[model samples]
Target: MSFLTVIASASLLAATGSDSIPRPAPSGPLVAPVALAVPFRAPVDTTKRARKAVTYSDGYYKRVAIHQALSWAMLPLFATSYVSGDQLLDKGDDAPDWAQTMHPIAATGSAVLFGANAVTGTWNLWEGRKDPNGRKRRLLHSALFIAASGGFAYAGSIADQAEENGAIRERHRNVAIASMSASTASWLIMLIGN
Candidate 1:
């Protein structure tokens, strides 16, 4: 036999504990196979893993729908506030300085929230329909919408307080509370559901 062939045979027999190779002594206690981490375990049952992933995806889509609906609901309210502010101020040729200033402020807050909602909602929808970009898009849009909604409500509340209108102040306060609750819920759902 060639020298290379003899060496290969010797190594193979040594690896298999043949008489040609001495075996090493055990130096540690024996242990059972480790329980794999969650991701690794999933591969053991491909179908189940696929189902769970699909469920997560579907729930994400539902959240997207909810985000869209909430955005739509906000739009009309924002439109009303913005137009009412403008119309009220426009009625007087020499509007009071405070009314003139407050109207624009109110309208501006309304517009900011509505615009932010739209931008975020659209991004979220696009993300949901696509795979590679879904997670990042969803997180970003959810955050943006929450900020927009919360900021707008807070601004509206401040405006109401500025006017010294008790009923308006209370109404705005309630609205702000509701907006905060929704934002919190949306984020929680996104994290848990996904």
Candidate 2:
């Protein structure tokens, strides 16, 4: 009946539909319908999309754990080798029986450990080459370890000459120590970083 009521009813009917319009009561005043406020939503896209898959092998984590264990194991081996080697260097062929026996054994143990680590580490490195995370650190670790491996190999090659020559023994000792230090640094970088 009123101008505002008519306008409100017209707007409400237009917003909804004719069936949604409120009916007037016989005895009471006519009430206009209240239009519900609906929040706006963008249309959803339903097309399927592909996600990138991880490239590493199933044994990746296992190798990582093994590599870490081997790295820790290397510390004691290094200490044993260093102590026994220092004794041999100081006393030459007259070194104590334990030092004479332990030095080569420890060195051999270290070599075996390094060889195993080299295989696992290099394989893992190749597998993870595409991964962007910590790539630089991994690369540096590999480089240092490789250099240490070369140093160890050189030291091993001179072992026979080292027995007869004091100078050669000292050089061997120095090379082995430097190699151990490099490997230790490489181990520390990964341990501390992760």
Candidate 3:
């Protein structure tokens, strides 16, 4: 997938980044999700765990496990941000003062979550680059994530500016939505590939 595919997912693309490649849902009992990768490396290829060559480092695995745990912990924060933000975006004008007050806080919450993703994500990606493996889907997924980070950052920075100017507000909302949507696509691609 190209970076354009990620950015354009706001309207122009579907799963796998482009409409050209349709992503059909798997039909059957729900399968397990991708086990999070090790913080600075990949885990034992559990699909091949029976092979002696694939082994896990307890210390490193634990470290990776912590990052993974934190990543999961972020979902609620992001969800809270999204829900509150929508409340603010729609019917914000007549909403109670408390609702207006909470909007920025919610956005901050999501930004905090994004911070975790940005830090650990880039760190892991840098480590992934040592090998030739990120050349395909990993490369695409990582690139899109970086782009999404920029989008969220821009949106977060302009929240105040948005309230004052119609143009700024529109831009803020657009980028924020696009960023989250694209980031989700990137995540799914990597997850399913794993």
Candidate 4:
């Protein structure tokens, strides 16, 4: 092999952590070769390891950017609504007036966030349908998130008609539990399957 080709091969193998090549063990020796190795460093594709280190991915990452933005807008709303709604559920009409007042406000925020997330997700799916670069798993990921969001919204709607600490509340809780479980599975599938 040519000299440059040999060096590139070694660098590529090292970059990939290939163990197929054996190395001689050093025994208390200062090494000029080691000292010279720096200039032959393997070129790294930093985008694979660090998002902020480099920018640019295919169409799929455009979807990811939207997902991140929606999450930032949605998570706080979901949390606030969930906590307040739970408190209201437990205390019924006897809940502290603040809890009663905040419950609806938080729920509204959650609903708006849910709508935003859903719209962004749908947009991603539409983009994927249009793009040759779209992977099947990414489409599945968006679809699954839509289903989970729907289930969550349905649960919330059911809760609205529920009497505090009553059967309908229990049902809403059950559905919410299932929706969260599905959401976890969807995330796992996207991360690994994608």
Candidate 5:
């Protein structure tokens, strides 16, 4: 008798045979069709995959911290050595007592600092030789520092000669300055890199 009832009757008649009778409609509201709904799925497991492990030696971080601190300490020592050495060169025996005393003291301090750094750095470098990260930078820094060390050693060997000969004194000063410059450059590379 109504529009929905007629439509329901037509659907029921179509589903059944021509001779079959139509069923009565329910008294509730109409429900929407669910034919287009997607089926449910479980998440895939990722924990079973294989992976490579990378590790560092014991005390690696501690050694790195100490190396960095010693590097920072080198700045003041370098400045003191340079100033005192310059005064000693310009004034010869007339140089101030403090300058004369501070020169060797600062030089010794720098040498000790470099020695400690070299040991720690070389050890760490060898330990991490397999690591691919920053390999080039580390190698360059080590090379520069090694060259500086040799320059400092040569200058020290000529110290006695430098005291007696003006020419040797100038060469000693030049070598020391060059070594200091190389060390400074190496220090800067690490500082900027990190």
Candidate 6:
């Protein structure tokens, strides 16, 4: 018979054998009694275990959920920044007060979104504690989000600064708008993927 078949047959025979008492003392040697122990444990308090399991699942859900939320939260800021920047460049002094106000508000919003994502992502990993893989993935997401946010923030700041100095006339403002768009898109994608 094949080796596997022989092993299987032996296992089957062993499993099917009767549970009858063994014959005592075929020879001279005396041995100590052996005890069989159960492998599975019944918990002393099952309710607590169930609660903890739910808590663990909730923690995971919250981490992913917040990241998803941050991604969405950034969309409007990005749009506002793009539209305002465009108007400022194209219409110059003719751009509405609201659009001009949006220049700073959009920059601030970008900062908030990026900062929140990084903080929350890091907190998720730290609070979870045991999953190294999850933590690594989160770290990558945090880094990307922060980098993208920083790029938009810095570029926006420079554009606004130049505007303050009458240096953001036309083409320069377009570059800032484009940079903000790319950064926001990058942040959104990173947050979504994570």
Return the clash pairs for model 6, or none.
Answer: none
lDDT against the true structure, each candidate? 0.55, 0.89, 0.67, 0.64, 0.88, 0.64
lDDT of 1 by residue, 1-194 (tens): 34455566668887887785643444555344467776535355565433223223565566567655654465455544545554443454364565566656555655665665566566546544544434564665466556746665575647645456655645554564455455545555555655
Error of 4 at 148 (Å): 1.8
Query: Which pairs, if any, clash in model 1?
Result: none
lDDT of 6 by residue, 12-119 (tens): 668879545343333444444458877977678763333232135676677768876876877787788778877877677899999989977886787777777667
TM-score of each: 0.33, 0.72, 0.59, 0.54, 0.72, 0.52
Q: Cα miss at 7, model 6 (Å)? A: 26
State the local distance difference test value for candidate 6: 0.64
Q: Where in model 1 is the C-alpha error above 4 Å?
A: 1-54, 57-63, 89-133, 164-194
**Candidate 5 least-lDDT 10 residues:** 45-54
Ten contiguous residues with the weakest lDDT in model 1: 47-56
Between candidates 5 and 6, the TM-score winner: 5
Candidate numbers sorted by TM-score from highest down: 5, 2, 3, 4, 6, 1
Ranked candidates (lDDT, high to low) = 2, 5, 3, 4, 6, 1
TM-score of 1: 0.33
Clashes (N, CA, C under 3 Å) per candidate: 0, 0, 0, 0, 0, 0
Instruction: Output the better candidate (1/3) by lDDT.
Output: 3
Cα TM-score of candidate 5:
0.72
Please say which candidate is ahead in TM-score: 4 or 5: 5
